[model samples]
Target chain A: MIYEEVLSGHQQELRRGTVVMAALATLETPGYGYGLLAVLEKSGLSVDANTLYPLLRRLEKQGLLDAEWDTTESRPRKMYKTSQSGRSLLDSLTAEWNYLATSLNALRSEEPNTPLKELP
Target chain B: MSSLSSRYVTAVSRSVPESQREDVEAEVAAAIADLREARLDAGTPPEDVERAVLLELGDPMRLAADYSNKPLHLIGPDYFPTYIRLLKILAATVLPVVAFAVMLGKLLSGGDAGEIASGGIIAGLGVAMHMFFWVTLIFALIERNPGSKEAKPKWDPTTLPDTPPGGVRLGDTIAAILVALVAVAYLPWQHFNSPFTDAQGQSMPTLNTELWPFWIPLLMLGLLATAVLEFIRYRAGGWSWRFVAINAILELLVAVPVVWLAATDSLFEPRFIGRLVTEGWLDASLHLNVTIIIITIGVVIWNLIDPLRKVRRDTAMRAKRVGSLG
Candidate 1:
């Protein structure tokens, strides 16, 4: 029998890189942390809020995201958006993801032990 | 402010740096409030929702560590090898030497068995503590440095025992910093409390007073930089061309101005020279100045050449070993 937890753990690992790309893409519309969390969940990336919040802060530290405390509400919320560098990063990450998918698919369909052709 | 959510938030905020505490606290509190409201709106029981929210957020201390980019450990694994190696070397070399020296000194002073034994043991313990404190402090700082994290290469078991990962001795680094610090302190001390006195009996500075406002402090600043560079070179571990370049730059920075000043007869004070000449301890034939220039240039050249040789030797040794293995 397949272990559900094991499968989910692997699934979580697979989703990890995608989650960064997702958050960077979502925050381009300019939203606060909790709002970004909801958007990620809606898109089928159920990132733990604990993980997402810290990650957002880390990205901001790396200059991949810009953050400002929005004081419009009674409680101030820190809003984040992808920076110019982040936009470029998101695009590159997206291209790389697609390239990986294509490579994986090619391997799957490949007949056993046919020598791998060097990339052009 | 005393609510469960605030409590949860405060736990994390308190762990981060104080400057970030207010901001992190406010942000975390707002996040927790948002989570609780969403959970409550879904018709979950109030108690369960708040408890679940806190549980999902996980350990506040860990979160704070992540937020502040502080490692949970005192010394990270990257520096652990060098740290262990340093302690082992100290235990083998310094501790026994210091203990024996103290015991000898105590015996010469006609101390009994009890006094000698106690003095030796105390001296060993003091030296041990001093070494441990400094070595651990340096490794901790290196671990905390952001560049250390990025520089962490993937560990390959096959690369085991490949030339000592850390090139320089920990003793050398500590010695550098200590010597520089003592020299820096000695400057100020000698300025005020010099054994050399004027005709009116005021203690006069040994170094030329005219060099005071600019050159002396510049020399001290250069010493401080040398100390910092020593620490950096030690932390960086492996010998390289880069370190050799930095070494040369630093040597010139300290030595050039010094040798130039000495050569121009501008380094030592007139009073000190007068005292030496009047006492027939020296001639006016530029003997001392020439010696100073010779020693300074010799040291600078050795300092510059030695590291370059080590880096080349290490690289060749590694290549030869890899070839032999193949």
Candidate 2:
């Protein structure tokens, strides 16, 4: 019973930071909350609305995402677009992601009997 | 916004700071409406969408917490390990030492058993509570304060302890030999030119003069044996089972008899006790024999266990290295 919980916990942890990276990258183009969620979900990156909304505000607070009220629609919505810093952050995060992917692949390909050191 | 969405947004916004309150409420209301609209457009009935959207958003209090950036945990992962490590250190070290001192002070000052127990236990618990409370408070504060992160010393692998291979440290052996030699010299010197004086002004050794014939010399021999054993340990560079056995025997040879003699009130000159009492140093009726015996027993137990523990550790370390090499 606990094993399932443990596995899911690990999977959630693995996806946690990637959610942030995904939001930052996708919001480079201006998008409303629902649109952003749908984009993320369609890309197989499901995020909780509660998590994403606060995270968007936090990113804006950190001067990463610029928020604007769009009253053009029948219902007013907050549109978010990544700021210059957010773009740079996304770039660095993408680079880090690639590096990690390569490292993980290298590690996975190694035989079990191989010396246990130097993941980095 | 629907009533449920309005309530959820209200709940989340109330806890947010006023500067951002109206903005967050508006954003949440818009998001909920969008969610409801999208689901309704996808052919879900309008009645179910509001509650579903609110449920999908999760608890409003958690959303508020996320916005406020205050961690829900008192001690998070960053500081938890350090907090626990320091707590264990305080428990193992400061708590016992302070408690022991409090108890000893109460004992020496002649408290009743209840008073001693209360004084020591209460003081110990108070210290432990303060250690925990303050350290936790400090870590919690540090966790919240962003600047304190940089203030912490950066950990480096070089700081790891690198112990030498041999079990018998040269300094320890030398110190042990010196202690034995000093006791050997001091015993005879004290016997000859005694420090304490009886009522007649004749020098009286603090130790019973009667002990000089058999017990004192035997104790001296034990000390000499310890010195020889220490020297052998130093030369051998590690403890074998044989060495540990002999070390235990040498330790018990001195400690057991001394503890027995002290317990029987034969170790000290009776006159010396009376003199101390007259000087108002010790309570006249108090029994010091138990204290001496306990301390001696504790020391002997420590002495016997220490070498054996070290030897076991050294053997394990050696075996690990050999296995790894093979």
Q: By lDDT, who's the top model here?
A: 2
The TM-scores of all predictions, comma-separated, are 0.50, 0.57
Candidate 2 error regions (>4 Å):
A18-50, A59-66, A70-120, B1-162, B281-287, B312-326
The docking category that best describes candidate 1 is medium
Error of 1 at B315 (Å): 34
lDDT of each: 0.83, 0.85
- Which stretch of 10 consecutive residues in model 2 chain A shows the poorest summed lDDT? A111-120
Candidate 2 lDDT over residue span B4-85, tens digit each: 7778999999977788889888888887888888889998887788888888888888888898786777878777877887
Per-model tally of clashing residue pairs? 0, 0
Q: Name the TM-score of chain A in model 1.
A: 0.89
Mark the regions of model 1 whose C-alpha exceeds 4 Å error after superposition.
Answer: A1-13, A61-63, A66-74, A114-120, B99-130, B145-326
lDDT of 2 by residue, A46-112 (tens): 9988898889989999999999999898979899999999999999999999999999888788885
- Model 1: lDDT to the true structure: 0.83
- In terms of TM-score, how similar is model 2 to the real structure? 0.57
